[model samples]
Structures are given as C-alpha cells and as structure tokens.
Target: MHWLTLHTSVPMGQQTYETSIQQAVRDLAEPGWDFRASSVGSGRSAATLRIPQRVLDDRRGARLVGAATGLRHDLVHRFDLRVPPARGPHVLTMHDLPPMRFPDEGRLPAWCTEPLPSDVEVICPSDFAASEVTELVGARRVTVIPYGVRPSFRQPAPSSPEDQRALGVSRPFFVHAAGVTRRKNLEGLAEAWAIAAPELPDHELVLLGPPHGRREELFGHLPRVVLAGKVDLDAVGKVMAAAEAVVVPSTYEGFGLPTLEGMAVGTPVVAVDRGATPEVARGNALMTEPDGPSIAEALLAVGRHEIDRDDLVRRGLARAATFAWDTAARAHLDVYRKVTG
Candidate 1:
C-alpha cells in the first residue's frame, strides 16, 4: 500500500512533533510501504523564515498536496483542516485540543474549530484526546494510537555521572522535560519545588527544554531549580537515568511522553491526575493533584524514598514495555486499510 505523510513545517526545536514524524517514517519505511512525505509550512529549506515566508511556504505546500494524486492514504501528523482532502482517504492525527481547553492561550482558527471533511479520519494519541475531539468537532471517525518510547530510553545503562555533571545537574534531582508552556504548569512546578526544596536537601529540580515567555522570570528566583535549557536526546536519557524521579505536573496532556520515557528508563514518575496522564501512567507513576502543595508533597515523598522505589521502577519498566513503535505502526496501517476499504 502507498502512503503519503503530511507533516507540518515545525521548526527544529519542536522535538516532540519531529520525533513523532521521524518514528512514523522509520517504522512505515521498514514495512516496504511506498511512502512519501511533504511539509505544510516552512519546510527544512526555509525553516528560519519569518511570518511572510512561512505563508509562502504554506501556500507552496498546499499546492503540492492539492495537485498530488493516486495516494492510497494521506496521513496528516499536523492538524490543518484548511488543507483540502487528498484524492484518497485522509487521516489526521490530533495531538491535543489545547486551544479549546486553554482559550487564554489563544483561539484556534475557524478551520481548526470547524468540523473536518467527512472523508478525514482522526487519530488520537489517547482516549482522553479522542473524547475531546469527538465532543468539540463532532468527529465521527476517531482512533486511539498511543506513542512508543524510543529504544534509547529503554536501554539498560548505568547512570552517567559525567554527563549529569556536564549538564550541571547533581545526583538525586527531579527532571521536568516538557516545554515551559502554560499547559505544562511550570509555575506550579516552580512553586512546588520551592516548597519541597527545604525538605529534601541536596535535591535539585532540573528543567529541560526551551523556556517559554516569562518562564525565566517566573522560575529565576527559585535557587533549587536548575534550568538546563535544551539538551540533546543522549543528555536527556542520561539525566533521566540519574534522576530520583521525573515530575510531570501538566494540567493537560494528550499523552504524557516524558512520563513514559522516565518509566522506560526505570525512573519513578510523579505526575498529576489530569487528562491522559493518569491513563498513560497506568498506576506506574505517583499520581498527584495539579496544585503546588500536592506536587510538593509528592516530590518530597519521592525524594525521601518513602514509597517503594524498586517496586515502582519494576512496574514502570513493564508498563513501558507494552508500548512499541512497531505496534503503533501496525495500528496505523490497520487504520489506513480500514479507511481505504
């Protein structure tokens, strides 16, 4: 079967989407599928473009997809319903409904909010996200496909103290790997770290990924918080391995990837009981409320090793084993076959 992968022209720093696309491409290619890919915005060639350049790239992408024909299915990893459906079945992967949940973040364009074309099937990473899309867009065809943790995350390697030192992270730290977005609850994390730092001496809170607007100002005052900025994937694995626990305090998530990654690496995770986090965590993580005090208590408990860390690690590894990229790829192929049939 032939497949056309439609990706958004996200900048290089948007690692999550990029990684998802890469994983999809790699696994799909392995099955000997006739696959082709095109980006909907400023592709790699024009990645550094400003707004006007991006508009031109979007137009170019639209022209390419619109003119293309004979593809068995077009899988859109980025949601842009404005792009008309292809000649064949169109599959859209909806990551989240952040705009609807957090209107203050920004209003979604009419195209995003409006019902998609009848031929377009939606793929949600979790049932939580699938329900939201169904309710908001009244979508009739939606499938749940959870993401797989990278093999590197599951590698059984000893903690890299040298790598941790290079990143300026000490041992026994809690890592927060998501971007500093409003949805990530960075403010709550900072507050929780401040409250918990006193109780757990020598324990630091490591913040990974790029800083969002005003994030530096908000988290700067917290001495125990270490803003490691953006690091390579190898660095991420190393840091995760050495961490006492990985904290995911997001109020919302389509699928909590970092939580899974931590679990894969045998690190305990403390995540909030919101959205798909509880579903993805699956009794593997220490569930907490989305408030500062609750997160603080959880962090303290984890740092003090009050909980059975060994048991948590064992359960987390087993849970992580259930998610595989090949499995997700097969599921996608099944969806494609079902849609085309």
Candidate 2:
C-alpha cells in the first residue's frame, strides 16, 4: 500500500506540525504503504522564510484535483485543504474549519466556496471542531480522532538540589508554556497571575513561549514574570520538571498538545475548561475558570504553596502515559487499513 499524504499546506517559513505529524505517520501508517507527499506549489521561498502562500490561498475551489497514491497503499489523505483530494480514496484530515466559505460563509469569508469532494472522507482533529464541520458545510462524512502524546516514565522527584536551583525555586513555580496567541488568552493569564502574585509571592510564574502578534500588548505590563521565550524541548522539559503546575488558558484548541507535554514531564495542569482542553486534561488537571478572578484563585493555590507535589506529579504521569505517539500512530494505521487493503 502506498500512502498519498498531500502536504501542500506546509507553511512557507515555519516548522508547523511537521515533527508530530511525521512521527505519527511513521508510527501509524499501514505496513507496505510507503508514504509519499507532494506540494501543489514549489513553495520555493520556504528555505528563505519568504515562502509565498498565494498558491495555497487560491486552491479553495472544487477543482478536479489529481495525484498518484504511491502504491498496494494507494490511499491518500489531503492534509492541506488548499487542494481537495478528488483523485482517489482519500482520508482527508482538516486541522480546523478555518477555511470553509459558503452560504453561511462561516458567516465570514465572501469569495470562497466549500469544495465538497465526492471521493473523500474527512477526519477532524476534535469532536468540537467536527460538530462545526457537519453543521456548516453539510459534510456528512467525518471522523473524530484526537491527537496523541508521547508517553514517558516519571523522572525521580527533586532529588538533586542543583536541579531545584536551576529552575529558580526551592518551593515550586507555576508554568505557562506556549506561543503567545490571542486564542491562548495570555492576557487573561497575565491578569490572573497578577492578581494571584500578591497573595502568593513565594511561587514564581515562569512563562515559556515565543512572541506572537500582540505579544507586546499581552505581556508589556506584566511584572515578576520570567519570559523564557523560544526555549527548546529539553529546556521546556526541564522547566516543566521544575514547576508546581502548568497553566493553559486557551479560548480554544484543536488539540491541547502542550497540556499533554506538561503531563509527560510530570507536571499537573490547571487549564480553562473549554474546547478540547477538558477532553485533553482527562480529569488529571485542576480545572480553572477562564475569568481573571477565578484564575487568580487557582493561582492563589499555587502562590500559597500548598499543593502535594508528589501526588500531582504521580497523577499527571499516570495521565500522560495514556497518550503516546506509538498508540496514536497505531490508531492512525488502523484508519489506513480500513481505507485500503
């Protein structure tokens, strides 16, 4: 079997979901189905970071797309929505419904039209998003497969004093690691942290993220916040290791990857109970309200320095173990098998 993973949607200058996506495919794709992918455009400026997205933007039409499904595994999945998989039996995966343009217009875009392909089966990242798919686009064919995390064993608790010092805490700090996006609700986090900071001056707030648009406005006024922007995974793991809890205040998420990452590092999470978060948190997290006051109260718990570190880590590790690229990959491979021989 040959896999046709249409990757025409890779961003010109960014890594995007390449790491996990590749890992998932490697772990899941059906045996004998050598995976093959092609981009509609050269995306020539990609290396230079000047990658133009014009070609991708113009592919919203219901064009009769054609492509080879590389082998016994001639099944392809159109991951990039730019070009619909109209050529073969495809397992179309949509990251989100950000591009649907139709009678409802998503009630937003005007020029675009929904390309309802005849030979494609759509797979959504989450049920929350899947509901939108079926509701708006009249998409009858859809499946919900949540993304999986890399499971790992829990590291020994703070046995090394040096490790404790490096994380900048004898006690424990709260961590908020992710890109600074509007949807991330970092502004609310900042306010919540601020309100809680006074009550619990002992616990530090270490923010780990790259500055996205409006970041300056987001954290410009924030104080006592350690901005470890753009840290590597090792650094993130170390930071997660050092924290008392991880915070996620996203207004929405297709899949909360960071929450799972935090859990893998043996850090318990406190997240807004919204979108795929509750599902991702899976009862291991200390749920928090999205509002500033409510979030402040949760932070107060961190600031008061009263959490059972071992217990939280133990539960987090247990929860994290449930999600693994291997398991996730296997699940995806099953999907491929169902589609092809």
Candidate 3:
C-alpha cells in the first residue's frame, strides 16, 4: 500500500508530537508499504501557501495522505483539501483537545471544537486523549497508540557535574522538560518548589523548554528556578538522565512523553495526577496532587531519598521498556490498512 503523511513544516521545538510522527514514518517504511511524507509548508516562511498547492496536487490524482498531525484552521479548514469524488482516505492524529478545554490559550480557533468530518478516521496517543477527541469531535472511529521513547533516552548516564555544567545546570537539580506554558503548570511548579525549598535546600529546579505567555511573571522571581531555554532532543535525554528527579506538574497532557523518557533513563518522575500523567507514569513514578504544597511534599520525598530509589528505578526501567516506536508503528500500520482497505 502506498501512503503519504502530511506534517507541519515549522520546527516543533521540544514537542514530542513531531518526534512521534517522524519515528512512525521511519518505522513504517518497509517492503509492501510505500510510505512518503510531505510538510504543509516548504522550507520558506510562506509555507501556509503550500496548503493550496496540496489541493492542486490532489486534483492531479487519488493519493492517500495521512494527516499525521492536528489540523489548524489557519493551515487548512478541512481534513483534506480534495473535494468529494477526488478525495481518498486520509487519517488524522488528534493529540488532544487542549484548545477546546482551554480556549483562553488561543492555540486553536473556536471552530476547532466543532465535530470532525465523518470521513476522517482518528488516532490518539492515549485513551485519555481519545476520550477527549471523541467528546469534542464526535469521532466514531478512534484508535489508541502511545508514543515511544527514543533509544537515547534508555542509555544510562551518570548525573555528572560536567554534564550539568555543559547544560549550564548545577548538580542536585530536578528537571521539568515541558514548555513554560500555563498548561505545563510552571507557576504551580515554582510554588511547589518554594513550599518544598526549606527541605530541598541543595536542589534547584531546571526547566528545559522555551518560555511562553508571561513566563517572566510566572517564574522570574523564583529563587531556585533555572530556565535553560530550548534544547535539542539529545540534550533533553541527557538532561533527563542527569537530574535528581524529573518533575511533570502539567495540568493536562496528551501522552506525557517526558514521564516515559525520565523512567527510561532510570530517573524517578514526580508528576501531578492529572490528565494522562498518572496513566503514563503507570505506578512507576511518584504521583502527587495538582497543587503547590502537595507537589512540594512529593518533591521533598524524592530529594531526601525517602522513597526506595533503587526499586523505583527498576520499576521505571521495566515500564519504559513497554513503550517502543516499533510497537506504535505496528498499531498505526494496522489503522492504515483498515482505513485504506
């Protein structure tokens, strides 16, 4: 079966959605399955113009393109640019309904909350995300396929001072790898650090993604908070490996990729029990309430080595082993076959 996957041309810095798509494309490219990929925008700044070009391409012939990422109205109003009679089967991957849930974020248009096209099949990264998509889009056919951790995440490395210095981070630090958005709860994490600071005297909180939306107001005054800015995926894996513990205090997440990444490196994860955080952590990492004091206590416990760190690491390694790109690709291939057959 020949397949084409549509993707965003813009570099999705530190976002695992792009990583998942790229990994899936690589794994699914095998004999009998002729897989190809195209971006919505070419390398130019006027990439949005490519949407119409895609429509023109569709007019040429029937081609099956996997809408491998979420749709934005500014990019394309419909799932496929092709009109009826010319349109072929196209699959969409809906990571989550965050825009619908948090409209104030302005990440998505109001019309995005409307029901999806009946002809489009959906792939969700987690059951939590699938439920959200089904409720928001009224999608009838939804498949749950979780993302995989890269091999770099599994390679063990010491939390050496040299590595920390290379990343401009100090030793005895807890890492939060998500972007500094409201949904990521950086403010709450800062508050938690303040609450836990009396106990965690030696540890600093290292944030490893780009800042957004009044991040200064949220984290500027936090004494121990270090904004490391954006880093590549390899650097992210190294940072995760070299941390005292990985904290994910997100109010919502589609799949919580960092939780697995932290666990894969044998680092304990302290994530709030919200959205898919608990599901992704899977009783391997430390779970906390979505508040300052509660999360503070959890962080303190990890910092003091109050929990059985060795056992936690062992469980995390085992849990992380279960999520692999090959596994996700097989599931996606199954969905592709079902849709195209």
* List of clashing residue pairs for candidate 1: none
- The alpha-carbon deviation from the true structure for residue 63 of candidate 3, after best TM-score superposition, in angstroms, is 15
lDDT of 3 by residue, 1-341 (tens): 65655544322422455556556657666677665544454234353425443343452321222232322211211222221111456677777766567755444423344576787678788889888888877988888988888777885665467767766777588988876546888777878988887777788888887765456677677777777777777768777887889998998887878888899998989998989878888899999888898999999898998999889989999999999888878887777778767
TM-score of 3: 0.84
In candidate 3, position 95 carries an lDDT of 72
> In model 1, which runs have C-alpha deviations exceeding 4 angstroms?
10-32, 42-84, 103-107, 156-159, 211-213
Question: Whole-model lDDT, candidate 3?
Answer: 0.70
Cα deviation in Å at residue 48, candidate 3?
A: 8.8
Model 2: per-residue Cα lDDT over 1-341, one tens digit each: 76656555342111234446556777554456676655454356333212244533444432333332233346766665544344556676665553342232122223224645444577766787677666655566777776655322234243255754654445457888766545677878988977887777666777766655456576667665665566555456666766777888876666677777777787778888887778777777777878888888877765565677568768877887776656556656777777665
Q: Quick one: ranking by TM-score, best first? A: 1, 3, 2
Model 3: pairs clashing at backbone N, Cα or C within 3 Å: none
Question: Can you give the TM-score per candidate against the true fold?
Answer: 0.86, 0.79, 0.84
Query: Which runs in model 3 stand beyond 4 Å of their true positions?
Result: 9-15, 19-25, 41-86, 109-111, 211-213
- Residue clash pairs of candidate 2: 1-33, 1-72, 1-73, 2-73, 28-329, 104-107
Summarize candidate 1's per-residue lDDT along 1-341 as a digit string, tens digits: 55666544432323454465456656666554566655544334542222333343354544444455334444433334433346555687776777787855554445457676666688888999889888888888889988877767884474577867777777578998886567888878888988998888888888888755556777788777778888877567667877889889999888878888889998999999998999998998999998899999999888887999999999999999998877787787778778767
